[model samples]
Target chain A: MESKNDELLEISNLETLDNYLSNMDNSKSNSYISKIPEVCKEYPCCLGIDEAGRGPVLGPMVYGISFCPVNEGSLLVELNCEDSKVLNEKKRDDIFVDICKHSNKIGWAVEVISPNKICNSMLGRSKYSLNQVSMDSAIGLIKAAINGGVKIEHIFVDTVGPADKYQAYLKNLFPKYKITVENKADSKYPIVSAASICAKVVRDHALQTWKCKEGHEYTFKEFGSGYPADPVTKKFLADNVDVVFGFPQLVRFSWSTASNILKDEAYHVEWEDIENEAPSPISNSTITSFFKMTNQKSEKPLNTFFSDRYLSRKVDL
Target chain B: MAIHIQSGKNDIQTNPKFSNNIHSMPFKIHADCDAQISKYFLQTPIEKEILSASFRGHPLLGKEIQIPAGYRGVVLHETMKPATEKEDRKFYVIHTFDKFKYWNWEKAPSKNDPLVQAMDWIDIAEALHSPVVEE
Candidate 1:
């Protein structure tokens, strides 16, 4: 336990956290886990899972899980891991540090799903929704904890979308373990609050130290809390938009706020697949064809080969 | 109007080298703008020969094509505009390329692509303009 605390203590510092995040590729999701407590492997543990930054249009959505012995649920409350929404940034960071300080009693992990990844998944051809991404992350964390030798016998998760559906799904996956899923589980359950705090602290730091893959540097104040309603975030989106590329990787391009801005500010771009999906206006009616033929000129039509490829003689360079 | 190319200062190299860095997108942008391709357009190989990349959050598949033999590609830049309609514009050779990679949105690049098919014209044009041969 002491050695685990020493290892975590080094990473608890903000500088180390920044280094850890900056070293990863900003375009993909990443996971980080603390060393499993020896006690957790020996005894049946109750694990809590929660997420943060899910609503933000900027920055990464983070899923965090915290686990301790089934009997030591009060230890989380003692560490001041209360409702993360009620806690400020400083309070969350302090709680996270305290959680790390008591590493022997608690262990946690986080999955940072990058904004670029969110946009890519949602806008992909198959169209993976945000809810699916969240569910996958939650499932991944639980699997990772179990794989890392944690004897998890009870699981609690803060709900995404409908609570009943999520609970049923998780129960199906882990039938041996008792599972509870509820709205506001972070506030109702001390273990979940600890998980929320872990997720929140990591997400806040991730936004603060975000290095744009486009080689642009920006402060948190510039993008604000990444909510679409934040004027600072809106201003940042409006100001930094490229006429061709739209926003950088920090902003979720699939979000309505970003897409709306792009529709107005950036040059119009049409993808072949998207364009082909639209309903064609031409009609097959004989009357309409007769009327169309009456207005046609007596000239030769271009070949279909050139038309299909959109090839044309260039009039100018 | 005739355009005068300043070949003395910016001579076209006989042995021109080309970089493999190239991309073709399936979307049309209605404006001319500069892009930071090297910084944002990172690519990875998804299969043995197929490459994958993304453009503005959309996935793209790419393949490289070599220029046909006995031919070279040149890039021309219009250095200066003519002061009058009758005056000739000045032009220069900026760069040359022998091969480039083309990309498609979520689709594999193939010979059926318009650009790839355009290369077939080189051989057809040679055949059309060839001198008559005596039997």
Candidate 2:
């Protein structure tokens, strides 16, 4: 994933996303892991895992894994890669560059789960919840790192769901490795911090260049970090909702924010009503029945038709 | 007169609370009629109703009616008997809103015209299904 940054620099380039998303089959889950090589020769290694952009209503959620020799803790200290959320974008980029420089000593992997994929999984008929998807992504990164030949002896993860259950799940997955899953593990462990930086940097890049595959030319600046709470994002959503079609492909329609916008602002035709079946039958009008009548004995047509059928027009209570 | 019914929820099927039971909402229908034309409005904006009705009477009547972007609902057409047997029969086309869909579109009308035109009925149906459909 480290070499992948050069392509990311070209924000509009579809190839950057392609490189990051290469080799994904799409038959199983929406996420796939990309691995970077390990630099250290140590017998035992510690792996730290963390994620970024999980809460945002926009953009992809990324899970990252970082590993290094147990004794190479000083290298992470030199990079000052801790609490990526607090670091400015420039600082995070700088720390990421440093990690890339020490690529031989530090190995990392990341799983980028796109916004469209997130919406699909969350809104799927099977109801693949976001938490389950996130768990799968975190575990995927760890598995990718190990399968790529990194000697992972100890694992530390920043938690989103219940920590004990998550930790136990990981422990059962790999009984040979020591696992710790807790909140704030990114700030507490250097490897987790590095992983957090990796995830955050990758997600930032992905969002910055996000082009709605649906052909919408939207940048992250237009959406303001893809967070529902961001005023600019809220305004963007407000300004672009389509009455008939709803929103562009960029939106997660399943999210309450998007759904509410559709309910409140976009058109809402009931496509499926058992009572009102497809090719909605024409309303049965009294005028039509009158027109159908042949050879009326009355000299004049019914002038009080509207008044006579007032009760018929009233909807049944 | 046009009346707006403010419902806090969307599709009745999507939300368990909003059942299939139809509530008698506040409804007002305004009518406009002339020698060659008749227009009926049910909560649809006066301007749009008049516009579509006017278009229906134009020489380009058979061509797709120029519905303003962001508006969608039923444009019902029914044949009516003329005053005399020799007189040409009349085609009555009434433009009415599906209260919820029309008002919702009124609140937000930012869709691109060509994009909506390109979308088929299937796209609209899938979108209305409360799921994200790929283009």
Query: TM-score of every model?
Result: 0.80, 0.56
DockQ of 2: 0.03
lDDT per residue for candidate 1 within A94-165, as digits (tens), equals 889898888887999999999988887887777799999999999999999999999998898999999999
Whole-model lDDT per candidate: 0.83, 0.60
Q: Which pairs clash in model 1?
A: none
Tell me the alpha-carbon RMSD of every candidate: 5.8, 17.5
CAPRI-style quality class for the chain A–B interface of candidate 1: acceptable
Distance from true position, residue B63, model 1, in Å?
3.3
The residue pairs in collision within model 2 are: A39-A104, A39-A105
